[model samples]
Target: MEPFVLRGPEATLSTPTPADVDRVAEVCADPEIATWTTVPSPYSRADAEGFVTQMVADGWANDMMFTWAVRPPGEVDGPVLAMMGISRTVGAPGEDQAGEIGYWTAPDARGRGLTTAAARLAADWALDPEGLGLVRLQWQAYVGNWPSRRVAWKLGFRSEGTLRQFGLQRGVLRDSWMASLLPEDPREPVEPWPAEAPRP
Candidate 1:
């Protein structure tokens, strides 16, 4: 699986390089990021280096995960505005394919649609028959993450159901909200936005 870049009208996503290590560490240090994401609480420079130099490289080379560093549209050297990825999983014995999508936006990049744009680019690429050829994409967030839910909703992920203590955050199992998008799904809100999120 060769590393690739995805571009959209509002975002560009490419694999992270060693140069992004500092910014990665800085973003991961955000208290909100630590609370919502599974990144190390006491995230260190070493962790960022591993992510940029090892985890990201291995994930792409092994075809297990395809992660990208999001930036402003067409700005390859711009600051990392967010991070998004798809962790692929083998489906049933004969199923085509499926994967889980995950992402986090940099503090200063929130409130705008950059994160959503990046996600749309990832989803479009991953689900394209001529691209990853995946049949389905799954999105899961801790039950209280309304921001994540809104993004998933805007991507047309149908609210499936909830799994009690099914998602591991940091270490403990927490209740999780689950949703799914298929290749044929429309890229529009599939259901009413959850109450936690203000109506669009």
Candidate 2:
């Protein structure tokens, strides 16, 4: 498949390239990102290269996933602010197609809402009939990943409760909070903010 790009008001989503390996490694090496995401614990230049030159390429070639390197508009050649993607999910027979979303923001880029804006762009594109044509989008994160959960909630994904031992982070089983968004769901937050929720 040819590389595609999605431009939004605040960010641009484009295919990962070999040139991005160094910056990708730098971002993934942050302990906070490693702890919260599945990125390699001791992220190396080699890992970053493999992710861009192999994993990202293969996923796009096989139509199994679509990843975007997120950068601020007019900064496409600069360091990435985040990485976001949607992966195809197996559905029951006769069910509409579905995809799962995941993302991680650079430590230095936190608090700017870049990831949230990029996510909304990705989700909207995936749900478009002229685009991926997916019927629903799924989101899941380790139970305490309030930042990720907040992104999902802000995009109007219905909280679907928790899944016991649903994911493995750094080889350890962890519970996950799951959510889903359908084509008909409002794109803006529809419910009152929970007082106890942490700021994303």
Candidate 3:
């Protein structure tokens, strides 16, 4: 299947390429990724390349998941900054047509509110009838990853609940915060970008 590009207020989501492997490796080496994500502890260039070649390329070909690169607007002279993605269309047997979104920005790319904006865009697209008809969009982040939790909250995802020690990262089990938005929630108000949080 041909990869499709998705739009956001300030980012353009596209499929990853071999040329991006080096940039991905540079960003994955950041401590922030190690702190919040499941990236390898000693993340190396080879690991990034292998992942780009296998998990991203082969995975997309096999219909396991869809990946995208979050290119920042106005970046024209250097490495194209990117974010990793893994999502399946809703209702493919056990998936229930529910698309879950997740992302991480480069180190130098933090504090810009880009991820939050991009997430809202991605969610809107996923929920569109032409896209995935996703009845629910979910986000899960480690308890202490305030940045990610903040993005979810900013995008109108309510604090549904938490799963205690539901994930194992590195060598320890960690608690995860789970939040979601449903089609009938009426909480996702239709308005301008950065919509106000619906009153609970």
Candidate 4:
């Protein structure tokens, strides 16, 4: 798939490039991101380069994942505020069409609602017939990741309960919280925020 951009009033989402490696490496060093997401621990410049030249490349070339960096509008190679993507392995002849959303924010970018805005744009596009045409978009995070859970909820993903050792983060099995958003669901909170969620 050709690279594309998603623009919104607050941010512009664009594909990452080699020019972003320094900033990407710097941001991924945040302990919070390493703890909550699958980005490599002790992230390095090499890892950042691999992500852009490899994973990001393969993902788009194969149409299995569509990733975008959240940056201030028009600063394509500037410091990245956050990153997100929708991913899925397309299944056989009659299998269900589904994908999952994933994201992480630069530590300094937290509390700004940037990641939530990015997630909304990606989810809506993935579900629109004019976009990816997916029937379902799922959200999963290791248990205790309240911020991620809150973002999914804010985007109208119905809480689907927890699964034991359901996610692998850097190879270790971890319990996970799961939820899903159907194409027909309203793009607004459908359930009240859980008390455990961090207050805004």
Say which candidate scores most in lDDT. Answer: 1
Candidate 4 residue 171 C-alpha distance from true site, Å: 2.3
Query: Residues 54-81, candidate 4, lDDT per residue (tens digit)?
Result: 9998999988899988898666666789
lDDT of 3 by residue, 132-192 (tens): 5677878888877877877777777777677999867888889988877766653343323
Ranking by TM-score: 1, 4, 2, 3
- Clashes in model 3: which pairs? 90-97, 90-98, 91-96, 91-97
What is the per-residue lDDT of model 2 for residues 1-200, given as tens digits with 9 covering 90 to 100? 56698898799899889889999999999988887889888999999999999999999998878999998885666678899999889664356789999999998888888988999999998888778878999998887887887888889888878899989887699998888888888997776643135657
Task: Give the Cα-based TM-score of candidate 2 against the true structure.
Answer: 0.92
Point out the worst 10-residue segment of candidate 4 by lDDT: 88-97
Q: Which 10-residue span in candidate 1 carries the lowest summed lDDT?
A: 191-200
Name model 4 segments beyond 4 Å from true: 90-96, 193-195, 198-200
Give the Cα lDDT of each candidate.
0.89, 0.86, 0.72, 0.87
Which stretches of candidate 2 lie above 4 Å from their native place? 91-95, 192-200
Provide the global lDDT of candidate 3 against the true structure.
0.72
Number of the top TM-score candidate: 1
lDDT of 3 at 87: 73
The 10-residue segment with the lowest total lDDT in model 2: 191-200
**Candidate 1 residue lDDT tens string, 87-143:** 888665356889889999899999898888899999988899888878999999988
> Which residue pairs collide, candidate 4?
none
RMSD in angstroms, all models? Answer: 2.2, 2.5, 4.9, 2.3
Model 2 lDDT on a 0 to 1 scale = 0.86
